[model samples]
Target: MAISTIGFDADDTLWQNETFFRLTEQRFAELLSEHGEHQVISARLLEAERRNLAFYGYGVKGFTLSMIETAVEVTNGQVSASVIGEILSFGRQMLQNPVEALPHAEETLAALSGRYNIVLITKGDLFDQERKLAQSGLGAYFNAVEIVSDKSADTYARIFSRHGDGPERAVMVGNSLKSDVVPAIRAGSWGVYVPHELTWVLEHEDAPEGDPRFRRIESLAELPALIAQMT
Candidate 1:
């Protein structure tokens, strides 16, 4: 069956995401190491994030607060104010820095625009996602931009409904194995996995082996030919 609608994931799928976080984390590790083991700070932050998902969701703002909270906890309120200032500065840079789209992201998206209904399915803080979209300059290619709190089977189903395509007529393309593939497949859509150079550890999962409806491509530039073959 030919695909009528395509859902694309944001962040690492189109523009760099994890790299910023990774760089920030390294800075964070350096500062926390001054107190004791870096792992202690890492563990505390993860625990706080797990606890704060409902309260904070995704973005630099929440992440910065989580880092600050973890630092205070790990240091028993002895973490230096200077270190906190550095983390805050890092977060500000991440937010304000302009982002460049991944290789072939713009071109492929342009090619796919008129041929198929394209939608951006992203999960993150609304403001941050919007800021990135505005900066990306690829927003015009998308028929819709969805800022979902989570990517679940139900979320895909709902989005499919709104797009006027049933799961059978839609395809999902993204970097994350968990968010972009699993839920999409569960909702009965075709899923295409385009692995990014750096995937978040939390988003890592096993792909469905030999699934006829699932296709994995190495890069976005390969998508047009793949879609042509599928159609």
Candidate 2:
């Protein structure tokens, strides 16, 4: 079947997201300089994020809690209230950060909007994801919006079935091979990898070699052409 729907990931795929997280992490390291080296701090924070995913899920709120948890762990519970306050401020700053569309993001959406059913299929804190979409000014281009808790084969199957023709007729586009590409492909959708400069470590996964449904593009600019070729 021809591809009837195009699913776009919101964060680093369409606009700047992981970049803010990177900046906040640098600030986190600076705030905890006395406790440990940046590398140690970052590793501990990542460990906390991985462990806490089931509890806190993904987004700045969870990241803030992870940083605070790491600070308390590294300091043996000696982390001061002032430092905790700074970490909270970092989270708030991240929440309020301006949304900047990545190069060709808007143009790609515009080019494909009418021809295909454009769905924003992203996973994250619901409010944060909605805020980014509204601020991005690209919401109008989407035929449907899905702010999911996580991306999985089941998730894609359900979403594409509801919003478009089905996973068999949908293409999932995003930066994360783990969350965006692999699961979507497993669900019977085309997985398009558009790697971002800064991806969260947990999201890293080797591409599905020899998978005919899997495609790759340097940026969103190449997406329209690729879709045309596929059709």
Candidate 3:
């Protein structure tokens, strides 16, 4: 089927996202250095993030909370107020961080926008995602924007159906195999994996080895040609 709609993931796929998270995590390890080894602190923090996903979903606020929780845990509930405050500061800085569009992000969007129904489908804190989109200066290219809580097969099915011809004629491009590729391919859309240098560990998964609908590209600059080939 000819592709009509293209779905894009907003975080590391479009702009620098996980880099900031990784930097903040390093800061977190430094903050809790007195309580535990950096590796242990990071592991516990990841655990907290995984455990709290149901309550906090995804984004900087949840990350901040997880860091706090980890600090408290590592310190045996004796984490200083000063350290907690510093962790909160880290989240604030992340929220305020400039949204740097990945290379070819705007160019690829521009190339596809008029030719296809371009939809931004991403999951994160609603306000933060909105902020980044507004800051990106590439928002004008999208025909629609979906700030979803999560990306599952059903989520893609509903969004693609609502926004375009549906999953059979849709393509979802992103950095995560777990959230962006696997589920999207399962939903019957072509899943294009554009690996970013610093994807979150939670978002890692093996690619579908034998799926014809699955494609991989090293950068967004190649997306336009890839789509052309698909068509």
TM-score of each: 0.94, 0.99, 0.99
Q: Between the candidate structures 1 and 3, which one is better when assessed by TM-score?
A: 3
Predicted structure 1, TM vs. truth: 0.94
Per-residue error for 116 in candidate 3, Å, reads 0.4
Q: Write the per-residue lDDT of candidate 3 for residues 175-203, one digit (tens) a residue.
A: 99999999999999999999998888898
**Per the 3 Å backbone cut-off, how many clashing residue pairs does candidate 1 have?**
0
Question: What's the ranking of the predictions by lDDT, best on top?
Answer: 3, 2, 1
- Structural RMSD, model 2: 0.6
| Candidate 3, superposed: residue stretches over 4 Å from native | none
Clash pairs for candidate 2: none
Candidate 2, which segments miss by more than 4 Å at Cα?
none
